[model samples]
Target chain A: MEDQDYSPKSRRRFLRKFGSLGLGTLAVSTGLTESCTNPTKDLESGKKITLLNSKNELVEVDSAYISNLNKDLAPNHNSESRKGLPGKKFVLVVDLAKCKNARKCMDKCQAVHQLRPDQHHLNVLLMKDSEHTAPYYMPKHCQHCDNPPCVKVCPVDATFKRSDGIVLIDNERCIGCRFCIAACPYSARSFNWVEPKDAEKYKDVAYDIEKNVPQKKGTVTKCTFSADCLRDGKLPYCVSACPNGVYYFGNEYEDAVTNGTSGETVSLSELLAQNSAYRLMEDLGTAPSVYYLPPKDRTLIPEIEDTHS
Target chain B: MARLNTIVAILIFACSLGAFSQTTAWEVSADQATKKNPLEILPKNLALGRNIFKRTCVSCHGEKADGKGLIQSTNLIDEKFQKQTDGVVFYKIITGRDKMPPFGAMLKEDEIWSVINYLRVLVDPSAIPPPKNVKLELTTGEEIKSITAIVLSADSAKLPLNEVDVHFYVKREFGLMRIGEMSNYTGADGKVKVVFPEKIVGDSEGNVTLVVKIENNFLYNDIETTAVKKWGTPLLSHEDEFNRRALWGARDKSPVWLLLLANGIIAIVWAVIVYVIYNLFRIKKAGRIFIK
Candidate 1:
C-alpha cells in the first residue's frame, strides 16, 4: 500500500485508450499535424510553436501555431473557397500596340503568383491572319466573359459568374472534369497535368484569398485579370509590363480608361472610336472583359521566325 | 493744243508704263540674279504661292500660322522638331518624307516651291510688306508657325505632373465653315511639341485653325496644358496614310514575346495553384465524397 507503484500496464492502457484522441487533438491544435509527428512531447523544435517556418527559417507570424500553418498555399484560378470581392466590375483592355512579347511581365507575374514553369495565366498567342504578313503576340488570359460557356456546362455550378463579372471556380467542388477547358473559346483555360515542382518550391507562401493561394493539384486555371492588383489600385503585371501604352484599364462605370502605365485617362468609347478597336473573336460573343484594338497600323510583337533578322 | 495733248498723254502713259516696267523687271531675271525685293514686283508669283499654300498646307497647320491644322493632320509646329530648311521642306514635299507620302508624283516642282513660299507668308504675315499705295487690312492670324514640342516628365521639370494628359485639337473655319477634331494621350517625357508647317494655309484670313490641345492623364482633373498654336485657312487633309501608319507602327511595334512572357506570369501562377490542388485530394478511395 505504501509503495503502490505504476506499471507499464497502466501506461500502455493510457496510450491505447487516449493515444489516438489526445495526441491527435494536441497535434492539430498546436499546428504540428502536418509535420506528421504526434503532438505530445515531441523533441524537435520544428514541431515547436515558435517563429520558425517549415524550412526552419525565422518568420514573423502573429501566433506561434501560425508558424507551422500552411496559410499561403493556394490552388489555381479555381480555389475551393474563393469568391470575388463585391461592388466592383473588373475590366481589362489589351492594346495590341503596346505589347512587345517581353517576358518580364510573365516573370513578375509567375514570381508573385508562384506559377508552374512552362505554364502561365497568360499566353502570348502568335496571331496571324495568314503567314504572309506579320505575326503579332496576342496575350490571351481568361476573358472572364459576361457569358461564360464554361459556367453553362459545369453540370455542377462549380464554375460560375460573379456579380462583378468574374468567372470563378470552386476547386473544392470541381470534379477535374475539364469541361470548362474544352468549352472556352479563347483557349484561355489550362489543365494541371502533373504536380508542379515550382509550386512546391513556393510551398511556404502565405495564401491570400484574392490570389487563390496555396494552389493544390488537379484543378483548372486561367487568367484572373490580376484582380488583386486592381483592388490595390495598381496596374496588373501585363499592363505594366508593356512599355508601349497598349493595355487600357478602366472602370466601365466611369467610362474611362488608361494605358497600362502613365494612367492617361480617356473615354473608353472614344478610344475605341479613335483606334478602330475590336474585340477578339467577336463573332463568338463570349463578351470578354479584355478588348482588342485591331492590329491596324503596326505589329506589336512579331513571330520568332520573323524577328530573327 | 496738239503739243499740250501730247504732253498730257505722254505723262499718263509714262506713269503707267513705269509701274509696268517695275513689275516686268521681276521676270527678266527669273532664273538669273536681279532681285532688289521680289515681293513688291512679283505679284503673280506671290499670288501663286499664296494660292498653293492655301490648297495644300491649310489642312494640317492651322489658320493661325501655328503648327496646328484645321484637320489636325501631321503637325508642322511640333516642338521636338527641328525646323526644316526651305530646301528640306521642298525635298519633303517632293520625296514625301515620313507621312507626306511622296507628293512628288502628285505635285510639280514649281508647285512645291510655291507652296513653300506661301508657307513663309504664314510664318510671318507681317513680313509680307503691303503694296506701297493700296490699303490692305492686315488681320494677322495666330503667329505660331512650325513648332517642335517635347513633354518633360513632371519630375524632370520639377513639376507635380505625375499623371498628366495631352490632347491635340484641330479646328477649321472657311467663309462660314467650321470643323474640329481632338486627340489625347500621356507620356513619361511629360511634353509633346507640335509643329505647324509654314506650308499650311490656315495662317491666311478666313481659314481653319489648328492648335495644340492637351489634357492631363487623370480623367477627373481639368486638362493642364501648354499654350496652343493657331493656323489659318486652307484646310488640308492627309493625302496618304503613311504618317498614321508609321506613328502607330512605332508605338505598337514591340516584340511579342515580351508581352507573352510578362502577362504569362498570371497563367503560371494559376498553374501552380492547380498543381497544388491536384495533389491535395485523396485518390485511394477509388472515387470521391463531399462532406460539406
Candidate 2:
C-alpha cells in the first residue's frame, strides 16, 4: 500500500510549524529552507516573486530574490520587535596580570556561538620571534571597534554600528564577498564555511538572529560583542569561560566589571591601572574593546614553552 | 656543438615532415577552425587555442592534460608548456583527422592541419626544444607560532616528569616565587602539558614572554622564556584574529559612565557655585560700606 494517506496541504503546513518559534534548529546539512519552493520578492527587478522547481539548483526565479535579504536572519535592524536590544553600553578590562592563555574562554565562546572549533570569535595565538626569543600565546577576538573597518567596507551596509556603539553584522544581507575580512586590521571577522557543522549537534541552543544563525557556509562572521546575551541579561560566553580570569564583562553604566566565569567584581579603571592596561593596535586607531595589562615582573621563566604552544 | 647540431637536424626533419602524424598518437585534437600552422602559431596565440579547446572538449577530455593539472589547481609541475610543441605538432592540432573536437565552425580548410601541427609539439615531451633560462619568485611572512607536538627528532631529550609542583619565580634581587602545578607527569614524548588558566598578552607586534618552572624536577630547573625562542610566543592564525582585537565597549570604565549618571548632580553643584559667587559680590559691597 502507498503511504499517501495525508494530503499535500497538511504536509506543507507540518513543515512550516517546524522551528517556527525561532529557537530550536531544524536546518539540515542540505540547507532545507522551510518554504522550499516559495519566493516573496525579487532581488534585481524588485517585484513579487515565485519559486518553482528548477533543474537541480535553487536559483532565484527572478532577479528580485536579492531584495529583503535581512528578512530572514538578524532582524535586529529590519524587525521592529528587536529594534533596541541594548540602549546603554557595555565595557570590560582584562587583567593581564593573571593570564596564561588557558584557552577555556575560547572554547566556551565556540560552544555558545555555535562556532566550529577552528572558526572561533576568540583566539589565543602564540607570539614568536627569532629561534631564541621568548614565546607566549596571545588571545584576541572581535574588537567591536569604535571605528570598525569591517563596517566601513561592507557594500550592502550588512554590518552597522548600534546606537550604543557596538558594531554588529547583519549576516542575512552579507554578500559573502570577504571584503570585510581584508579591511579589518585586527582580523576579527570569521567566515561561515560549510553550513556551520557545529550548530546542528547542539540542537538546544536558542537561536538569536543577531548571533548570525546556523552560521551558514560562505559568509563573513565575527563576535557580536555578546549583545544577545546582554539582551537576555546573561553574561557573554567568553567572560565566564576563563578559569584563570582572562576576560571581564560588565555594563559601562555600573563603573565596574566581574570576571565572566567568577562573579568577582573590580573597578574597571583601577584594574587597568594596577595591571597596566594597553590596547592591541593603538597605532592603527581602531580603538579595540579588548584591553590587556602587561605581564611583567615574572618569576620562573615558562619552561613548558615548546609544549603548550 | 653536438647538441646544437642534433637540434638543427630534428627541427629540419620536423619542419619538413608536417603536422598530421603526431597529434593522433598523442591524442592532440583540433578544437577550432581558424587555427593554422607557424604562419598562425605563436606564443601570443595560445589563448585562441585555449578558448577553442575549453568550449568544445573540456568535460571528458580533462584540462590541458599535463596530467596533475585541473583549471584551478594552479599546478606548477605541468607549467612547462614549452617543452612539448614544435612546428609539426602544430599542424595536427589544426586538422582533426583523429578523435578530437574539430573546429570546422570558422576555419579555412588548410588552416586546420597547420594548427594541429603546432598543438602536438606542445603536448609531446620529446618535441619542443629546451628553454634558455629559468628563475623563480617566492614571498613569505615571519613565523611567530610555537607549535606543540611530539618531537620524534633524534636531537631531542625525552624527560620522564610526572606529578610535579611548579615554582614560578619572578626575576628580582629577592625575587618573589609563586607556586602552581599540573599535578601530573609529563605525557608521552617528554611532554608536560601546561594548561594556561589565563590568556597570554602579546605586544602590538604579537610578542610576549613566559617564565615556567616545575617544582618536582629541580635539576631540570626553571625554563625562562628568554631561552627558548619558540617558548612564550604563540603563532596567530594568518587570518581573522588581527581584526577582532581592536575593540573596547561603547564606553570606557563605568566610573566614567557613573560620571554621566551624575549629570543632574553636577548641574546642581554648578547652580550652587553661581549662587555663592553672587553672594560674594554682595558681601564685598557690604564690607566696603561697613569699612567706610
Candidate 3:
C-alpha cells in the first residue's frame, strides 16, 4: 500500500489535488507526505510541487524535496528566552531618597512571580551608611550585573545573562545546587526548598524562563528584571506598581529613563550625573546594572515599627 | 457646682463649633460668588475644560466627575456642586483647601474659565452645542525646528478658524508627549506656530512624528493632522553591546577564553579516559596471547 501511494501516477494525482487547494492545503499535504516517506532520500524523484517562496513569489520544487516545517511546534522557551531583547540594555535606577519602605514593589513582584510571602524577588531593606547618618529604605533586586557572579557560578547553565542586561533562570535546568545563591553578593536569589507556590496549578503549564513562572521544587528563583514585561514594552511589574516613584527604568542605549510613579522621562546620563547615582557594592566589581541614588534630602523618613514577640 | 456647669457648657460649645466647621461651605467672597462667567458655554470650551479635567482633576474627581477617585473629593456632578455659580466654583478651584492643590498657579486664567464651562456641561449635557467639522494643516518650518498648524472650516469656503485651541504633541514609546505650552489658540489668521524642543530623541533615522490637533473647539471639534520630520536626535543603537561576547552572556555568547578553557579541560579529561580504555583492551589481548 505504501509503495502504491509513492508510485509516480498516484503521487502526481495527489499533488495535483493539493496544488488546486493553494498553499494552506499544500502545507497539510506536505506534512502528510513527510510522515510516510523519507523526504531527503526521495529528493531526486523529479516530481514538481508549487509553493510560495520567502519573497512571496510562486516557485516549483521537487515534491519529494518538500520538507514539512513543524510550524505548530512550541517556541524553544529555554533557548530563545535566554536571548535578550535586541538593541536594548535595560537599566534600573532606584532612588533611595524616594523609597519609604512601602514594599509595594516587593508585593507586586511576589504576586506575579507566584512566590511565597517569605520568598521575595524584591526586598526593601533599611540601611544606615554610618552610625550618625540617617537610615533609608532600599529596595534591592537582582542587580543583573554585566559580570554576574551568579551566572558564573552556575554549574548547570540554568541561569544566564541576556544581552539586554537581564539575568534570567531556566528552572527546568536548575539543579537546586544553590551555588548561585552562595556566589551572589547581593543575596538576591531564593531557593524553592519545597513545592513552589501554586505548584499543582502550574504542573501542566509550560515553563517560561523569562517570568520564571510555574516554578519547580529544588530550583533557584530571582528577579528577571521583569523580562516578560519588558518583552511586552511595559514597565516591570514592580516598577509600575510602586506608588512613590522610587524606580526609573529605561533602555541604556536610549540614554533616557522614565520614573515609574510620575511617568516622567528624563535623560539617564543627566539624572545620574545630577543625582550622584552609584551602584550597590561598586567595590565588588560586579558591574551591576542597577544604580542607586544616595538617600539624600529624603521626602519620607524611615519609621521602624518594632515587632514584639 | 455653678463653676463646673459653666466649664461643661463651654466645652459643649467648642465641640459644636468644630462640627460646624467640618460641614461649612467653602468660602467665596460676595464679589466672587456673584461674578458672572466670562467665557461662553461653547462646546469648544467644554472640550478644553474636559481635557484639562482629565489630566489634572480626574485622579481625584474620578472619570465620571463623581469624586470616587483614589482620593475622595467633592463630586462635580452633584446637584449642590452644579448649583454653585461658575465664579464660586472658580474661586474654590483657584484657592484649594487641604487635599486639592491650587490650580491657579498651574493653569492660565482663561484655562480656568474654560474648566468652569466644562463643569457646567458635565451636569447638563444639553448645553453642549453641536460639533462642526474642521480641517487641520501641518507645516514644518525649514529654518527653525518649528511646526505651524493652520485650522480651517472643512466646508468649501475654507475660511480659517480663529480662537481654536491647537495642541501640539510628539509621539513617544509609551504615550504622546505634549510639545508646547497649554492654551495655545489660533490667532486671527487661524494659525499657531510652536517650536519643537531641542534634544528630543527619535528613531534611528531621527524621524519624529509630530501631531497637531484642534481638539474640543465649540465651532470645530477634534481635527488632527500628523507629519514626520527629521527634527530629533537619532537614538544611539546598542546593537554592538548586545552582540559582544562577555562573561555574563548566555552560554553561546560566553567569552572566548572561558569557552576555550572549559572545553579544553573537558576534552583533555575525555582523552585520558579513552587512552586508559584502549590500554585495557591491549592488556586483555596480551593475556589471551600468553595463554595460547
Best by DockQ: 3
Over A1-309, each residue of candidate 2 has an lDDT whose tens digit, in order, gives 123324543423433443243322212212224233442223236452343221222322333222232223322333532333432445656655345565777877777677777787878776564568555556777776667777766777777765444677766677899888998898888887677866556344433556655576777778876776666666777775655445677544333466654444555666777777898789987777677766554211244346646
Candidate 3 residue spans exceeding 4 A from truth? A1-79, A93-105, A124-138, A242-248, A258-279, A283-287, A291-302, A305-309, B1-62, B65-121, B124-132, B214-220, B231-236, B245-292
Residue B258's C-alpha lDDT in candidate 1?
Answer: 57
Per-prediction DockQ scores? 0.01, 0.01, 0.18
RMSD of 1: 26.3
Off by over 4 Å in 1: A1-87, A204-209, A299-309, B1-292
Error of 1 at B166 (Å): 12
Question: Candidate 3 on A1-309: residue-level lDDT in tens?
Answer: 667666765654454444555443234345434533433444457777777633355756565547775443222344567778776788999999767676778888888898999998899988867756677888999999988888888888888877788988888889999999999999999999988888877666656788888778889999998887788889999887776568989887666787766565666888999999999889999999999998876545665554663
Q: What i-RMS does each candidate reach, in Å? A: 20.3, 24.8, 4.2
Instruction: List where candidate 2 sits over 4 angstroms from the true fold.
Output: A1-87, A129-133, A198-207, A297-309, B1-292
lDDT of 1: 0.51
Top-TM-score candidate index? 3
lDDT of 3 by residue, B182-237 (tens): 66888988899999988888888888888887764655667778999988888776
